[model samples]
Target: MNQLQSLKKITTVVADTGDIKFIQKYQPKDATTNPTLILQAINLSCYQNLIISAIKYAKLKGGNHQKKIVNASEKISVLIGSEILKYIPGKISTEVDARLSFNKEECIKKANSIIKMYEEEGINRSKILIKLAATWECIAAAKELKKNNINCNLTLLFSFAQARACAEAKVFLISPFVGRIYDWYKSKNPNEIYSVKKDPGVLSVRKIYKYYKENNYKTIIMGASFRRIEQILALAGCDYLTISPVLLKELENSLGVVDQILNNEKKYYKNNQSLSESEFRWHHNQDAMAVEKLSEGIRKFAKDQENLERILSKNF
Candidate 1:
């Protein structure tokens, strides 16, 4: 069997692209899209209809209301999410504006707004996962949203402190990026060679998995941002692994025996109960790689959102 087929026996695979073509082919249980992927897809000929429809819908009700135009952006966001949901048997994660990462109130407000938009289209709340950066404020916002039965997928997680806070907050899921962590370490040490199983990125997610399993935290750990196929194989039995189209194809074409690399039934690490805000900040600060990558990821997402707004501005 191909590795992708083998992987399904052990892990819940998720597509990490806004491109519906790939999601259709791989047929992941879940799919995730960000401003970067959506914006890129919007410009393609295949998705042009979605853009035009979103603009027309915006102009009709908006009547030049700036809020409505921005709602056009949100409208397109929901429309795309709805389209992806048709193909996804599981939940589709739609991210809130990254600019509100540090503002708990604003994050909660926007997440609710997005959820409301989805609900307006008759999409159930359970079918969606409101995504937010794993910042302290965002985690706080997610915690509050969970009370109302709204789930969340905390993105841009780098430090163990961030993961711990999400668990304590009782958030729905945490996506600890494997590729970014590996990239950070590889950049730091240019000469040393790394193995698949021993990869720093793989080890990071494994550490988080062991901690959560040992503590019996209910938050799902989805390994994401993988740079190599080896990294994905290294994390075989993780709760979920969000794979991009590029690597998804590679896995579908390659043949190998995939093992159950992670299992709560087998390994567990004793983790502390909870961390205060100060403690979270201090630990995050101490980790140089996490500090740099977390900031960089946020900046990139923010910039991509800004670019999407600029594109929407010209047409709508």
Candidate 2:
């Protein structure tokens, strides 16, 4: 078996793209999307129909120019997610607008709106995982949404504090990014070459995986944003790994023995105590990489969201 087939034996592989063709090709159990990916897919000829549908939906909803554009952007997001859901058996994570990342109330409201739109499309809430930036306010919003049985996947997680808080809040999932973390460290030491095992990104996810399993936290850790197939191979037995299509194809071609590097049986350091919001903030602040990356991530997503809006507006 190729590495992809072997890896699937131990971990749930998820496709991290808005493009349905890749999702269908990889046949990942789940799929995830954000504005950046949606924007990329919108320019493709195949997705033009999805855009048209979103335009019609937005027009029928009836709002002012800005409101209509926002509505259409949201519609296209859900529409893409809805289309992807038909192929994958597990949930699809549709993100809340990153502009609302720090506003607890707006985040919650937007998540609910996404959920409602999915429901209207005949998709059950179970098949959708509302994604929010892993900000303190967004965590609070996720906590409330969880009470209503709206499972959330907190994205842009870069610190243990973020994971700890999400676990305490009983979030359904947390996507701790591997590639982005590696990129940050690599930027600092440009001349230094890091091995796969010593890669900071791989090490971070490993630490989080062991901590979650040791503490028996229900929040599943999905290692995402992979820069190379070696990182994916290193995390062969994680709960989930949302990989892009290019890396997924690489894994499919390479024939290798993928071992289970992570499992629940191993004992590791554990933090049983929950973090208060301030404590969480303080701990997260101490990590310079996390601080910068989290902020940078939010800004990038917000910009892509606006770009998606502009594309939607032009089509109308």
Tell me, by lDDT, which candidate is best. 2
Give the total clashing residue pairs for model 1: 0
- Report the number of backbone clashes for model 2: 0
Question: Cα deviation of 48 in candidate 2 (Å)?
Answer: 1.2
lDDT of 2 by residue, 1-316 (tens): 8999999999999999988788888999999998899889888787889889889999999878888899899988998999998899999999999999989999989999999999989999999999999999999999999898899999999998898899888899999999999999999999989789799999999988888888778898999999999899899899999999999999999998799998788565556678988899999999999999999999999999988887778766
Pick out the ten consecutive residues of candidate 1 with the lowest summed lDDT: 265-274
Candidate 2, which segments miss by more than 4 Å at Cα? 266-272
State the local distance difference test value for candidate 1: 0.89
Deviating ranges (above 4 Å) for candidate 1: 60-66, 266-272
Q: After best superposition, candidate 1 residue 106: deviation in angstroms?
A: 0.4
